[model samples]
Target chain A: MLVGYLGPLGTYSHAAALQQYPEEELKPYGTLEAVVEGVKNSEVELAVLPVENSTNGEVRAALDALIAEIGECPEIKAVGEVRVRIAHQLFSRSSNVSQVERIYSHPQVWGQASHWLSSTLPGAKCIDCDSTSQAIERAWEDKNGAAIAGSAAGSVYGIKPLIANVSDRDENTTRFLVLAKQPAPENKQHTMVTFCAAQQDLCKTLEALVSSGVQVTFLTSRPLGTHWTYRYIVEFAGALASEQVREALAKLNQVTPVTVIGAY
Target chain B: MLVGYLGPLGTYSHAAALQQYPEEELKPYGTLEAVVEGVKNSEVELAVLPVENSTNGEVRAALDALIAEIGECPEIKAVGEVRVRIAHQLFSRSSNVSQVERIYSHPQVWGQASHWLSSTLPGAKCIDCDSTSQAIERAWEDKNGAAIAGSAAGSVYGIKPLIANVSDRDENTTRFLVLAKQPAPENKQHTMVTFCAAQQDLCKTLEALVSSGVQVTFLTSRPLGTHWTYRYIVEFAGALASEQVREALAKLNQVTPVTVIGAY
Candidate 1:
């Protein structure tokens, strides 16, 4: 199946998409909206977008895409989740890191730029860009500039790292969710879904799910950005082959209005 | 004087603006660009915009505004800095905590949300919003939904807390910078400045600041989102009156080119 994800090329999003399905060719979409749109339009069978990071929490751009697709039911659901270790590299044409006064990279890459600035190119000024790979392109264009980006982004942008594997932390990683236009991956061990609650007691609803034998793996919530209503997203494991998952969902139907955005 | 901030109302930006000159009628603008514009056009004499937060780093919307106004030199520097403790309330119309099914709040409020989501909304789902106050407004409208937002946001949105003060760390607070077209307020002890580095090694530069006798009270770095470099924002106590800070900065000038975004 064709997989679409956010990227100019060599972005963490692109990497995560490839990691989810090793054999599938990851199609790089310019934006998250486009990735989701690709699925909606049947251009791609599945899409992968970042949901959150271990340290940073949620990626709102991806979350927003999920919300926009809520009304478009059965279009997307979590098939799998990929964890990616994030390593930032400082790339430059100049051999000396100290000679780099200007740094270029995507805004997210720049967010983690402090350590590199303090330790390496301490005097470098930062400029933002559309993506990490783009930073490499700019760095290549501007000899005085270095870039803060993924090591792979360096290769994509055709630049070399003055410093490699230079993120401040070793465990730094991002979490990406797999999506598909069809039903969530079938008869599997995990099922991911998003819903709108009819009532306020989300815990109460969750207890109901647990009581019905659903095994929740990951959970998060966000505001619909509408009149005080919220949206709930849950990932649970129940043999997707079993009707038990559907039965548990039926219980939620009795107590509250639950619209499953997607089923893994 | 009436003060406006970048907000839709009940955002941290509004609270930060209010803290500087409390009892001022604080109007929330839809965007930071608007907040700067509000000051430029004299729709409001002063506005509060978050320069950077301790947690997620700089507020891109604000920095981009300043960059766009580079030539105009808004005659503004950060007048004051605020570190507001993030106290999140789990608000639902129903007093029963168990009745809450979904939680809504801004990304900044996430630290406060983990407890409630783990202990309370774990079974429910999570969603992200542009602001904490907006989350409350949405949650307040849904009977089954709850919000993890600021106390100020709850008060304005008419959301009743199922639980009060839920942050992973009590120190969960955000720092905000106050700005105006002209000087707003000053403490001889503190001067907030934004600068571009001659080098990206901010840590070493900060060390130089220390060696030069600059006592840094707070420091934050963020991606400029321009081409590929980031901006390092720092706050420290030293009299601009002393000319010592400038001298130290001038010394740093040799190490890196410095563009003082603002100083007051």
Candidate 2:
């Protein structure tokens, strides 16, 4: 098996890809676009992308990238879901934590580890790098610099951990979705759908799903960006291929706009 | 009146604060926590914080900050809402766009303007600064650097716009919420509620709101971080103080965990 993920290496996505397809060839794509492109172009069998974080909510770029491909490109469907526990390790060239004069990481990682950073390296200047791997690379090159990233990234970059499990929340985790050219085999537990509906029609649409007895697992609304109108992505406890779920979606489509994205 | 916002000066929050209270004294708080803290401590009469962006969706930090204060601290309510059009300006020490060897901006701004940058300044190295204002400050100090920020921020930092309206989307806008120690006078047009509910009970909850004939304006769910459960923030076209809305909420409370964050 071949898998693609966002990385230089040692990112949460990297861990997720490995967790899903261990012993398979894993390719690291520098950007989200590249990872999706890898799947679209058949450069890889499937791509794993971070969808949301427990603490931060949605990963905007990843969702935006997937949504952008909805109408114009090869239909990449989410086939599998994986959740990875996020444990940030502060890595530096020197093992001594006191020698760290600067800290570097992706801005979001900085937020996750802010409490530890404030208490441990109060005076260290924080620098924003493009990715956690890039931060590790910078910390490896600069003796006075440290980075917060996956512990796996530290070993990959040949840096040692200055501190372990530095994120404020021990239960911090990220949800990743596996994207491929096809949807996953019909899943009865959940079906992900995306739709755009007028403000007045929203309740009616939700009523349809509820009336049909399908349980909603996740619900999120994003602005379509031009008008005040919004786009909603929903995951409900049902299968797209099932009769009750299909009938519910059919009724929703009659009253409002809706698209069944995936079932997993 | 003194108002607090996230800023060096010239961030969307700064623009929002000025838009809401043109004649008031705007105090630039460097962090979201500080802006909320300013309101909690009565250091500023109120604060403006960016809650969501049209292009990218919710600003997780601001939402999390507000949610964190739900039970642990003094109640801070959203008193007002402001939507500002995002028109990023490329500013530099020199007026010549071709002379720009490096580009500086916040990561989100960079993502918004990536299409323009790749075509216009193909060779320029991109640097991520703490804020758009900080980006402008860096550009002002470096002759060969350019920053992407609000035009007002560029002018505030004494840097001239090399180009205007560089964001890829012309309709890009951000929605900001005004925070104060007290809630706004009850808004009949809409009420905002934040609550946690079970996945199975979600359908019953939506059915309750819709059955009461209250329109749901916005709906979003965030993972509670520890368990597989989720927390939801909802805005509906009815007042919390109204009879219909109260009846609907009371019915929901009977089945699931729910909280009324604000009436406006």
Candidate 3:
């Protein structure tokens, strides 16, 4: 299947998409809109986007696109939840880290790396870019400049890493979601549901679910940007075969339009 | 009151803080944690953080810290709200935009500028950094580099703007939350709430709130990184002062610990 994602290459979305599908089958798009359109037009079989990061928050374009899709949009079926292992390295084309006068990477990295960078390279500054590879691309032109990105980015932009995994925590990972016209089969172990809540009551929601017997596997919530509205992604187990699951869903339909994002 | 925020200067947060406080009373913290700690230690009378962006997503660190503080610590209190006008600019030491070989900015700026950057500076490499001021600081050390950041960041980092308002959209603005140890005098206009729900059945929880007459103002849900589950920030109208609101919250609290983050 053809997989579409946002890239100039070397973005985590590209890495996660490749991890889920055949690398050779990867098709990169410049925008989240284009990626979604690819699936809608059948230009590609599936699209992958960063749904949320452990530290970053929700990718609004992805969420906005979700609402924009509405009914005629693809049935966002199976979610290939890929947890990207982030290792933001200080990269360059030259010899040592001491020679670096400037570093570059995504702003999220810069925000996360502030304490270490301000201490480690007191004089050197960090530049922000769209992707880690872009940092490498920028560094290729300057001898004193370095880039903070992943090791995978090194190959794409023809550079070497000055240091590896400069992030604060080693357990840094961003979870990605796969959007397609078709979701996976109901026999899948993991299922994802996205819905908007009128209130921020997690307890009552859980009560209703547990009262019906749906074992939650994982869950994440993000804002809908309209003051105090939210959308949630919940991963639950016990297959769609369980009568309790069906009955619980019927009960939920009474509350809101709970879209089955995926079952994997 | 002296307010602190992440800056070399001229980040949206800086502007947002100024909009809220005015009178140029911001302390300009280098890191978000520094800002949080500043508020905690009373280094600044108050601090501001960009909670959500219209086109972008949560300024992750701020959200993480806020949730962690409200849910885990409860030492800090949400006090005020401000709207920041985000004006993306292409900045450089050189006055000519055509001579610019590279561009820099925070990843959020680059994400918002992808289309414009791709079309405007196709050959120029875009890199991400900690903030707009940081990007301007990096570009100042290089002659060929241009940075995309805020107009105010220019004066703060000693750089100049080549073009103003380079974001993909013009209506972009980020809403920041002002935090303090003391709560603001009670206002019924803005109310913030934090709640945790069952990993499954968020719909049911939300239904209880809506059915109870809580008109949501803003909502985004994402993982809190505690127990691998999720928590949400919901903005609603009217304070818990109203009997109906208190009753809804009381009933909602039966299912979850629905705490009032703040109402201003």
TM-score, per-candidate, Cα-based: 0.51, 0.91, 0.67
- Rank all candidate structures by their TM-score, best first, as comma-separated numbers: 2, 3, 1
Backbone Cα, N, C clashes tallied per candidate: 58, 0, 27
Candidate 3 versus the native: TM-score?
0.67
Candidate 2 docking category?
medium
**Model 1 chain B worst lDDT run, 10 consecutive residues:** B221-230
Candidate 2 has which clashing residue pairs, if any? none
Winning candidate number (TM-score): 2
- The per-model lDDT (C-alpha) reads 0.65, 0.80, 0.71
Which is the leading candidate under DockQ?
A: 2
Off by more than 4 A, model 2: A155-160, B155-160
Tens digits of per-residue lDDT for model 1 on A1-264? 788988888788877776677898778889887888888887888788787654344576687677677566555666667888788887888888767778888756554555646776666777877788888878878888887788667666666677887766566678777777666555666665666542244434554565565655444444432322346665556655567678767776766666554444
Error of 2 at B123 (Å): 3.9
Model 3 chain B: worst 10 consecutive residues (lDDT sum) = B220-229
Candidates 1 and 2 compared by TM-score, better number? 2
